[model samples]
Target chain A: MPGIDECLLEAMKLPGARGAAVVDWTSGLALGTAGESQSGDHEATAAETAELARIAAEYQSFAPADGSDWSDDDTPVEDLIVSSRDSYHVLQFVRTTFDSSVFLYLWLGRTEGNLALARIRLREMARQLVLG
Target chain B: MLHRLAAEKATGSLMRERGTLYLSDGQVIHAESPDTPGLDVLLTAGGALSPEQWGEALTEAGPQQLVGRFLVDRGHFPEGALELCHLGALYDAAFFVLGRGGGPARFRYGVAHWMGAVRPVPVDAVQRETSRRREMLNEIWPEDDTDTQPLVQTGLGLDTGLPRRQRAVAELVDGVRTAADISRALGRPAFHTLVDVRRLAAAGIVTAARRPPRAANAPTRLPETSAAPDVSLLRRIKNALEAL
Candidate 1:
């Protein structure tokens, strides 16, 4: 039942978690953000991550083989993880009652963060994100 | 006027012909427009909240200007849901309000929306997103008339391979409904529906119902009983709602 701010605060507690945000991919708007962003600005980070989310969600090639035709329902891609030299970016998609176009982003340092655990927890958070 | 208000950290509503933008401490808290779907429509139309519940919420919490908090606290819906819808509705209306020059923008101080503030967006962010949306629509199809004029589905629609979302919008084009009408029917944001409409127009699946140009001596304003929304009256209604 955690709202956006509470959710982001929870995300920051993860080991080596630098920052987190909830973003609407369609509009490239960040609904909420917490902690420090390596990109210096949270808005800029939102737009960049939205681009990645849009690519994974929009393209047919990114969908699974046996999945139903991509319509307005939840996208087949569950989560996206990008590894840079020193950090990890994880985006977990949330299925809203109205529109399933939002995702939670977590920025983690490569050394202290557990990618597997972070991914699992993010999925849980996304599920707990009540839409209506 | 909007930028100046932001600079001065003013809190109130900015009234324009297209809509109203509510800013809290110089940041946008909410927006509403007659031509765009509101949060109530998005909620009830999307089936996320029943009309009865919305009515009850209004009766119980609207007077206190805590409908948003009340709904969340009552467990009728989550805060994120309300906030997200509010954000979408704001941007949808702000698109029409921004970058237009037909009428003047009047600012009133110390006023707040009854829906309450969920998030405060900077004026620059709102402006940036507005322009970005305009560019996106232009990139898909560079025409403004399709946004306001009645839309018609061409015979080419049956054969056109359109995406599912766009298909739904195209199917609603009866040569009578405008983009705003289609948007409210679909329970989606007007801007998103406009994107689909513009794409449909570009793909030849839909077109704006064309009309003959008026004579040079014709008045710029439409005749009485026009379909166009009444901005002044709408603004008064908005003010009355806030007062109540």
Candidate 2:
């Protein structure tokens, strides 16, 4: 599996891929971060974004109208996208048997980044991530 | 034992059945689980990166060094904020990792991290707080399987005595909107909304199904914990479990 450094380097190769972080959403911690000249606080942004994702995911699971349909095991998150005029915030939770509660967070300049490509890169990075 | 390990300021990896979660100085930094979507999903879901980018990144270079270095070198997040984000992510991930049942969890010490510069402020308070909230969530919902399951509300009964947030959420869910959609619709900060959700679930205004613990699953024919306790709440819980 790819180590933290290798993953960040790979992410930067993406078009307009501004910044990336391996954030532990469970505790809102940034495991590793990369890229340059960020616009805001990377760690806080990561924590906040993770918070948003968790709330969004949990809310989706607990909404009232969903009582009759509680037969399944968990909810599927297609994505949690929060966009500003020039920036896009992403929080991806990577689930492996080793650590199920962590996520990898990425931030990009909306104008410079290719959203679709960035997502694919992050997914690939997650698959190769080894926690130790 | 886990708490004791943390108190020892251990530096090592905690292994779980599904995956592994890493911790430094009792602060969790890395976690991987098989049951839920990994970091890629969180990133893509937020629309920062697309599937194609993930694929290309993988093909062009390995995922390890590339993703890690990119996060630190890119963007302009302040130290305080970055620290906050890191702490939040750790706690959120821990909520799922440490709480998983039916598995053996082991912690091996003496692992040093070269990426300590990337580490943020400590997350002791935040983690403790999240754990408390998780307990409350469990008290109400009593199930770990709901993390990925589709949420359903049957337009059940309720009283006006509930908190406004709870009332609002209940009313909204009663309308058949998914919980995720409601969270987006509410547009409130996630932390506040989630606390309210926990309250609603614990109050029985919301429900999820799970097999009760042996303590709770005792048959009606079995002797009770106390035959005539003056407490009414205990009686109520006992009644509920008996019905199950």
Candidate 3:
């Protein structure tokens, strides 16, 4: 599995990828970062994205209502995507045995970035991203 | 002191009252403390391994100085999970070790932790991460005393908006158990539990007893009792077994 730095480098290779970071949503800390941050401040972006991820993941409404058991194995939500006129921000949750509060944040330039490709690639990267 | 050791490319264990940090070529390879659960507790308490499994691994690899490799080779857990847990335990212990003020620290050259090295982090990185964690707590709630005191609910019904983790922490707050105690009870990392408790305090969802004043001229001698069994002899026994 690719570690945080390797995964982040792979993320930066995605088309129009401007910046990428592995953020622990629980602590709002950036585990790794590459390229220019969308918000100029990587720390601020990490904290903001964590807030968004926390809100989305904690709400019961985000999970499927089929009366299925709620567990870490069952991801409450997949990737969270936010788009502005000029850019796209993607937060892909990474599941771990201990906590699932980490995610990959990718900022892409809208004019050149492919949202669909970034989303798919980020999900794949999240699966392979190793934390140590 | 660590910076000087790192500069000299020193090897061995730095023993303090709160914990022990193993360094190899100036890099931190392992750490353990009584205040925080070690890697063994993290794995077992987190339900990653049974006590029997851990004991077996210890028996097989503790002497060989390859317990980390043994677990991975035996498919007990993935390399990633092992490293993550090891790192978590290391930092958690390091936090207390660093915070232990005025205590004498002893360093023995060429010593090693029985578990061996899963991953070695730079001395600087460990220090930086510890400071970052401290800053995070301060940013959330400026009061440091709340960390050591037993938690008490405000009884103001202020928990309606608490997150699941914080709520779980709140439920464990019996006005008796401190944050570290609750952390063990929940099988969560001490640092993470502190973060949650700080958040709860920041939100006025919970309150902590007033911190007592420290005595002037308190002796800096290392505490005689530790929270966990001493594993030094186990390492020696394992060494003998490996020699056989």
Candidate 4:
């Protein structure tokens, strides 16, 4: 498994990737960051993404209503993708035995980035990302 | 002091009453404290490894100073899992270890932690991270006194807005346990618990016990020592005046 910096570098290798960060949603702190942030300030961007992650993970409506009990798994939201006029942002949650409140944030150029590929790659990276 | 050590590229264990910080080539590789649960507890408490397996690995590789490597080589746990748990425990203990002020500290040259170095973080990076954690907590709740005080769940309506981890923490709060105690009981990182406790306080869902009165009554500042009269001379003059 790749460590935090390596994992971030791997994320940044995605086509048209502008920036990548591993953020702890609970504290709104960036554990690691690579490349240029969309907002220019990585800290502010981390906090902003954390707020969105918190909202998505906490709201009851986001919980899966399928017959299977959703409470068994801690993940309330799998991945969140935001598309803007010029860029795309992806947040992929990592499930762990401990509090699963961290997410990988990736920013990509709308024109050159493949949203589908980035999203798929992010999910895979989130699985193998070693936080230590 | 850590900067000086780092400058010299020191390799040793800095031991204090609160905990010990192990450094290799000036980088902090491991830390352990009684205030926070260690990697052993984190792994076994979560049922990732049985006690027997942990004991076997320790017994086999402890003398060789390859306990961590042995565990990983034996497939007891993935290297990533071990590193994560080790890092978590290291930082958790380091917070308290570094926070301890004016304590007797001793450094033993060439001493290394038994688990060995999983990932070495620069001394400056560790210090920056520690301060960042403090700032994060302050942002959530301005009061620093709540960090050590026993937690008391308030009757405020704010409890409903708590996140899942905070709710779990609130449920464990019995009005007697401090954040550190709750963290140990819940098998969570002490720093994470502190953050949640601060957030709970900020939300008015919980309150910390009032700080106790300090024993020292000394003034915050005093005049320059060179300008101040000698203490014995002043005492003698006062005694002479009283006798007169």
Task: Report iRMS (Å) of candidate 4.
Answer: 4.4
Off by over 4 Å in 2: A1-132, B1-12, B24-27, B34-37, B49-66, B76-86, B100-102, B107-117, B120-130, B138-150, B157-205, B209-244
Tens digit per residue, CA lDDT, model 4, A1-132: 466778889999999999999877765667678999978988789989998987787666675664212234435578999999999999998765443367899999999999999989988887676332
Compose the digit string of candidate 2's lDDT tens values, residues B32-65: 4453344445444434446676555445433342
Q: What are the per-model DockQ values?
A: 0.36, 0.03, 0.26, 0.22
Give TM-scores for every candidate, taking all chains together and pairing residue i with residue i: 0.82, 0.42, 0.78, 0.81
Expressed as tens digits, the lDDT of each residue in B99-186 for candidate 4 is 7472877888898767777777788767766777777786666666668888887776445545667787888777789888887777
lDDT leader = 1
Worst 10 residues of 1 chain B by lDDT: B156-165
- Sort every candidate by DockQ, greatest first: 1, 3, 4, 2
* Prediction 4 global C-alpha lDDT: 0.76
Can you write out model 3's per-residue Cα lDDT over B29-118, one digit (the tens) per residue?
A: 998777776677777775668889999999999998899989888878766556656766777788777763728889899998788887
Per-residue lDDT over A38-114 for candidate 2, one digit per residue giving the tens place of the 0 to 100 score: 54666565566667765654553534454312113222453556687987766665643221245666777899877
Task: Choose the strongest candidate by DockQ.
Answer: 1
Pick the winner on lDDT between candidates 1 and 4. 1
What's the residue-level lDDT of B155 in candidate 1? Answer: 74
The runs of at least 3 residues in candidate 4 whose Cα sits more than 4 Å from the true structure, single-residue gaps closed, are A1-6, A28-52, A59-74, A130-132, B100-104, B214-244
Error of 3 at A102 (Å): 2.4
RMSD of each: 10.5, 14.1, 12.7, 10.3
Q: lDDT, candidate 3, residue B5?
A: 92
